[model samples]
Target: MPRYLISFEKGAMDHIPEEDFPEVGKTSHAVIQEAKDAGVFLFGGGLRYDDGDVEHAVVGTDGVVTDGPYPESKELIGGVMIVDVPTREAALEWAAKIAVACRCAQDIRKFMYDPDLIE
Candidate 1:
């Protein structure tokens, strides 16, 4: 089976509120369980807004480490899910289901397993 990254887009942030994102939360959990039941879930979770970790760090040829999202975007990666599926179509199907549950658009991209590195 092929692996895919099913990202819950940033637009979904609009639905979040302190009042209790019960609906969204419920659906998210359901989706996770569904993925587990389908035997596709690998590992996934929501992204944090900020942390004490180095937001930006760099390593020269001398050897260094860096932090922060390589390339930043106005919308952050809200959450993620890794699943093993047979095809992109199948992943898209699952993404669509998640979109309905979360009431937000989802970005589903197939993971590249390049061997020869010929793109």
Candidate 2:
């Protein structure tokens, strides 16, 4: 099995009305539950960047920490889900369901295999 990362970039859902967030949350959670029941979900969560209170730090090779994301990043991940499945098609299927639920396009990428990581 391989793990695929399904994520949506920040601001992707900005067009959605604030009052609809609860419904969005409900639909997204339902999709998450479906994935969990299918035994494919590994972990998922939304990032907290809208609050302005979020602390950003970047650690350098010199062991010094600097503020903020990489200087080149123009966007941030809004939410992400990891699913371990047997094939890319299965991952795409899940991503499609998630996209519908979250009302945002999803970006999917397969994780490279590592011997030390649990399969």
Candidate 3:
């Protein structure tokens, strides 16, 4: 099975939350259960909506500490799910379900398994 990451895109909440965000709590649990039954879900979670406040960058060596998201981007990671599926199609199906459930656009990406190259 291949691992895929499903992330919610930024600023998509407006469209889905106009009425209400039914995707939280109760509905999320149902989705988790469904994934579990299908044997593809490893773990999934939501991220707290926070501004870049309380964020800092530090360089460390030899057990020194660092505090930051490393190479920063305009958008931070919002939420994620780790899914193990037999194919990209299966992962996309799961990501679609998560998108509807989370009421946000989901970015589906596969984890690289090859060890020969470095990013």
Candidate 4:
């Protein structure tokens, strides 16, 4: 089985007004429920939807802690869903559902496995 990560940016929905967030939330949650019912849902969660340090933690290799969101992008990670499926096509299908529900672009990435961890 292959695990896929489906993630989106927070500001990607800036075109959508804040008033419509509830509806978007409902739609996305529905997709998560569907994934759960299909037994492919591993884990999923939404970011704090803020640009503050409270929502994100950055730890350096030296164990130094930085307070703030990721500096690489102005937009933060809105949400992420992880699924384990049989093929890339299945993962893409799920990504499409999420993209439509969130009304935002989604990045679907394959997860590399640790051979030693596989029993």
- Considering every candidate listed, which one attains the maximal lDDT? 2
TM-score of each: 0.72, 0.91, 0.70, 0.84
Rank candidates by lDDT, best first.
Answer: 2, 4, 1, 3
Error of 2 at 21 (Å): 0.6
- Where model 3 places Cα greater than 4 Å from the true spot, the runs are 14-19, 50-74, 114-119
lDDT of 3: 0.74
Question: Which prediction has the highest TM-score against the true structure?
Answer: 2
Clashes of each: 3, 0, 0, 0
TM-score order of candidates, top first: 2, 4, 1, 3
For model 2, what is the C-alpha lDDT against the true structure? 0.92
How accurate locally is residue 72 in candidate 3, as Cα lDDT from 0 to 100?
50
Report per-prediction Cα RMSD to one decimal. 4.3, 1.5, 4.9, 2.4
For candidate 4, the clash count comes to 0
lDDT of 2 by residue, 1-119 (tens): 89999999988999899999999999999999999999999999998875776446778899997777769656788899999999999999999999999999999999999979874
lDDT of 1 by residue, 36-114 (tens): 9989888888776567655445565878655544454345667788878999998998888777777677888787787
